[model samples]
Target: MFPSSRLRRQRKAISFPAGWQIIPIAGKYWTSGAADGLGGWRWTGNLEANFDDFTKWGVGQPDSDMVKQRVALNFQSLAAVFWESEDDTMSMRYICEVEDSGTPTSPQPTVTTTTPTTTTPTTTPPPVNECNARKALFIVLESSSHVGSANFQLGKQFAADLSRAFTGLSTSKLGFLTYALIYHVRVHLHNSDSPEEIVSDILSAAYEGHSTRNTAEGMLAAKLQLETYSSGNPMHMVVLTNGVSASPSTTKHIADLANLVGIRTYAIGVSMPDSADQELLNIAGQYSDRVFKTDWARLDTILGSVVNKVCNS
Candidate 1:
């Protein structure tokens, strides 16, 4: 069964047979849940392909409603290949690619190697500790009006403490950003400075309360930052907020796309209601451990656990 949980299949180049196409059972076909800018459409079948390998959008297709109409594909008639977006739950039929596993091949001849007679001392160091391994982490804090100035300050302190905890890890890079009316990239992912400097930057940032919570745009910014500056390191993001987004569906869709691109995201909901916590789950990619809820005063108490998960999870 195709697992819906996987936002996108393993990404790689896929080869299709001649005249290969997806024939709709009735009206339209269900294709990938890939929109335009969140890393172009891709083949998610058993065989894989590049991000843009299967893109062929119809005229004015793949519309702005990225959350609902995310599936992209083409029609079978007229020798046409114009992809279009459709709802994923629409009971439409599509093709599935399955790899052959029954064939057997001859085994290769065994070879042996001899140990070197001379020995030399090497200067290579041991592997970096997993908890301190190289990675790119982006922290996004919500600075909307719902998050009062006191709680916003608490969020800043929490971010500062978190950055300080990961300081001194030469390879691990951390950045900071805040979201409300607009998202600000206070620290870039490529900032190669001391953790103390990063902490200072975070603590010094001004939290001008915004009238709206544009978490989706903030997450998209974080995703772009990772894509541009992660240098192929493990990408992780932590979002701390107390209010629901002005566009929750967009926020959730962006989170889904981020997860598709291998961005591990975590969410912290500070003194949020049940409805808002649901949004936090979406931001966390619906992973329980990745979603933490607490009052603003106790936000720092979960620092240890968040750090542990960031390092080990």
Candidate 2:
């Protein structure tokens, strides 16, 4: 498998090894870094990897049975190199990327491969949650009229629930913001107060109830907040909404910018329409697992899952 954690929080790119097209097109080598997440296949590290691009997938690839075949590989040939579904247990070559700090202030990706070695098996430790690993999270709640009073309450509860979940994680930094016609930062990532404080702030804040859904503007504001109050940890953004923006393409453009800076974004939809779900998917880097959907009545059900992801992913 690929070194799953090396690019976990970095802005980097990965290209095929030089002359990779010559590699065996079949039964030769593939990478296991792409795995089946709860909802769909996801790259092990760096959500910014662009695995969501449909053009990168080979014909009939990823297969129909996403459950049993939990891993994916690359199929290389004279014509193309693309991804294909494979069994997780398969032995294969894996690719890894690292940042070349000497290149420039901007991130430059360089590939490095580790030769597989056989070693005596040992007890593998449990995965560390992101909260314990010093990660920063910013929650963006939609307060536009499109969300309505009922859904707005649910969004508040959702933020409050997350705050409670991350309250005692000493190393984690938390922030909260709301967007509609205007953007408001309820909490800063650098706030010395505990995450629990965010719960109160979120609940007490007034809803904007504006007609415009300035999702892109809110996202830009979030990027500024993270840059200004950076905890120097892996940063994540979660956007909760119940309606599509008037300009979803603008929101997607901002999302691409955020991803370029190593800010992984998750989109949660509350009883949103199909168009809004598509908008959320675009915001979530086109990954299904990163876009969670639920009605206001069942919003609480996904709170725990989102908390776990914020804590561990």
Candidate 3:
């Protein structure tokens, strides 16, 4: 492939005994037979040797017409006795070697190399928190005028009962919020609130006396307030409503947002109207089992289940 002296040196190193090595054509020598006399080497190696070394061709061999492309070697007339490669396939001979020139040749060496590999250190991550235990809970009571005087009073009574039942909670950290036409926080987290304080605040809470009840915006307000308190502290909400809020879709949307931010909501509907039970179910999310529809009197019966659901969430 190049003008390398090593190739010429290797070629000139050919050596064999007196008769050298003549391989018979019928079984060995390359020939075209040219059944149709097309021009080209019979074998690929011969093509590599010299498709047609014009300078080494016999007098008129491979002549202009050039149709006959085969070869034959007659050692008796060493040089200038070459024939067309395709002359004849049956009567041809191949040259494997010639008499030794007695010139000493050098041996080549083989080299093997091994590369070094590198090792990278693996890193471990911190453990994940499943939030299966309660940390801080925010009570979101429906104080809207939509609940009216009687319904709001019943809601307050139910909340006070539920709050007292949260005694010795898995976590002492607790909070409180109320929403009607708007949302308001009655207690912030981390104050080490006692069960008595939780019940008192719920019972004493007043109704909003407003017609608007966009529960979703109220939930978002609770989320923002909880975020301000701390991060990674499991959050839970207990919403007491007598009916579906005016903006139910907005209520569901913010409930979903609260869920995405790791806050679990447990909606309680006491004496709810019509499809309001399922509406509360939607707001409660995966804690749908925590949703309740009962009169203020039976509200105490499910307080234990509520605490368990919140703690084991």
Candidate 4:
């Protein structure tokens, strides 16, 4: 059994396949299967094989579903899992290829922007000094049909919790955006009045669902609304999705826009399979310095951690 005291720490450090190498929806140690179940492939090498053999040498049976099917094996103590298959004489050759993790050591830092337009200095803006400068935190809840109820509920809970926590801070503003069949980015309030109002707004947003899930359109709308409502205040985005974009180019363009606007994005994957838009999520998170994964049970904790990271940073 895993150590009880260290479970949380271990979970935070758990390593998974990510990066450009896994881009275009492919990985070196990837597995491919078909409906016929006759033609399949597992890619790995001697180094990975040896590591897997050594790690699983005396461990009776791995507890993971992927490991039980022999689709993955822990190659090292560094939380790296090697992809492989169980059948040896099925005429399915497991190819080996060199690969890297591709994830950055730390989250990407926030970027600043420069505009070409210039204006003559009149008053110099008084140095913009304010110890209690408020920041606007906009959460776009995609009630699109593409997103499941479980994801929507989790997003609502996260937004409520964040609003509550920030309400206590003197220099924080919390806002809510809910997208329905059409993109509707609603700002519950400009600046928070109380935690109860914030919670109510989140619940009301969840009650409304959009026709389809168009994250790109929703993100663009949210950016525009934030620009109009918050003005000079900083804005951060937290997007939750299970599947990949129907349009890859659109997703890339939105990611670029977020990066350009200094909007920190935290992408949350809820009940999404490893094969579903993992690369896009990683890229989005890489650009915004906030990518995470969790199911319903642990989503609240994940949101709490994310808020702390972004607010403190």
**Per-residue accuracy of model 4 over 218-307 as CA lDDT, tens digit each:** 565555445555656677766666556544455556666665777766677765677865544643645434777776666666755766
Worst 10 residues of 1 by lDDT: 118-127
lDDT of 3 by residue, 1-313 (tens): 1123423665667555565575533333433221111233322111123343332345565444332333443333332244443322144455442334667444348799956533221132122222344466677777777677666666666555555444455454566667765455666554555776766666666667766675754565566555555345677778877678766765776677677877788888877776677679778975667787776556656666666677676
lDDT of 3 at 42: 24
Best by lDDT: 1
Q: Which is superior by lDDT, 2 or 3?
A: 2
TM-score, prediction 2: 0.57
lDDT tens digits, residue span 1-313, model 1: 2232332442232434567674444346665344334445533332123344334567887665543434545655657656666644356666544443444334458999955432221133122323576778999999888897767877887887777656566877788888785566788887887876787788777776867787876787787778778887899999998888877777888899898989999999889888777898899988877998889867767888888888886
Off by more than 4 A, model 4: 1-134, 188-192, 206-211, 277-285
lDDT of each: 0.70, 0.66, 0.56, 0.50
Report the Cα RMSD per candidate: 21.0, 19.2, 38.9, 21.5
What would the TM-scores of all predictions be? 0.59, 0.57, 0.52, 0.51
The pairs that clash in candidate 4 are: 44-96, 180-210, 181-210, 181-211
For model 1 the local lDDT of residue 168 reads 62
